[model samples]
Target: MKAVSLVPSLTEAVAVTLPGVLAGATDWCTHPADLDVTRIGGTKNPKLDRILALAPDLVIANEEENRAADLDALRAAGCEVLVTEVRSVPQAFAELARVLAACGAPGRPRWLAQAEAAWAALPEPPARRTAVVPVWRRPWMVLGRDTFAGDVLARLGIDHVHAGHLERYPRVPLDELRAAAPDLVVLPDEPYRFTAEDGPEAFPALPCALVSGRHLTWYGPSLAEAPRVLGEALRAARR
Candidate 1:
């Protein structure tokens, strides 16, 4: 079975969900070995032909990630395409269901059950607000309103300070950050890594934590593992 997953978050989900869907080993391949592919969300990639050359039985893309022209070109090339635009974790579950249905795989009910149970098993968070900085410095950005990251934060019952105040991924000035006075400023390690020692001296007065971007940012089956990890981190920080 050939599957093409365009977005990294969905690709990671497929990698985990395939075993449950196919009920066995399925040879899955993705454009980027990792999430750093330029076209996905990084720099610039002018190569749609590479994906076409994969000669996939099916290609899954997100409306937010895949350009319409690219999808049209893929359709023209006779590839069956499934598109998912997931802005929140609940939407992510729906998208996963769509991919499973398109793949003609069984075991979705079981998968969804497990996912639901796992989500329920998550512990209630400490009653403190949290702000996650999904991008590292250079421009210094944070997940604002209407983003997957913001949704994940909400699921944890942790408030994102910028949720209603700004656009998605707004560039936050250091002064604004000082004013928000978040309980925690989480710097995720992707797009760039911000080590603990690398904490901006300019913000030394702020409470900060350098964290795994994959855990906080990936919205998929990977989510099954996130709440526990995030919960532990927050618990430790509370002490």
Candidate 2:
């Protein structure tokens, strides 16, 4: 079964689990480091021509990372596109299972089981702490309610100060975010590339955690290690 995966995490999931099934993937699908598939394009603006040229039997995409018009175009062109909606851990697992099964993956993949176990092993967080997590700068957008990353942080005992906002990814003024009096600032290294010197200075009064964006934001094979990896980073920077 030939497949074209637009989401990086799902690309890895399909490539690593099914092997030889992916005929094309987005440029951002960097996992399986040695992956040698046709480069279709980016997640938001995929090269529809190239994807169609690949003649993929299935195309995997995400509701959040991809554009609706593009998926509509693919469907209009008579291509079967699998659109995944992953907003939480359990939902991610279910979506993965559904996609894999739909694509004829041989039984349950080992990584899927490992990922489930990784999160299940974590004991309930003792006491939750309020945090401001900025995903981008220049305009300053944050993770709000119903985000997968927010739930991951919640599992690690960190609550979002912007969870009540109207937008899932809201752009708040920097001053207003600081005024919220968050206990810490959790910075991920992607979607904005926040580093120690650059991000920590914004909140001199609060402890800052520099986390891996893949572990904190992505939903796939990384789930197997995200819990331990993100938890350690949060704990190390706890004030």
Q: Highest TM-score: give the candidate number.
A: 2
Instruction: Write the residue-wise lDDT of candidate 1 on 82-159 in tens digits.
Output: 888778877777777877778765657564666667777766754657664547566777777787777776777777
Candidate 2 Cα misplacement greater than 4 A, ranges: none
Error of 2 at 198 (Å): 2.1
Candidate 1 residue 83 Cα shift, in angstroms, is: 1.6
Off by over 4 Å in 1: 19-46, 109-112, 132-134, 200-202
Reference-based lDDT, each prediction: 0.64, 0.92
Best by lDDT: 2
TM-score between model 1 and native = 0.80
| Model 2, span 1-239: residue lDDT tens | 99999999998888888889999999988898999999988999899999999998999999999999999999999899999999989999999998898778867799999999988889988788999999999999899989999999998999999988889999999899899989889999988999987788888888999999999988889999999999899988877
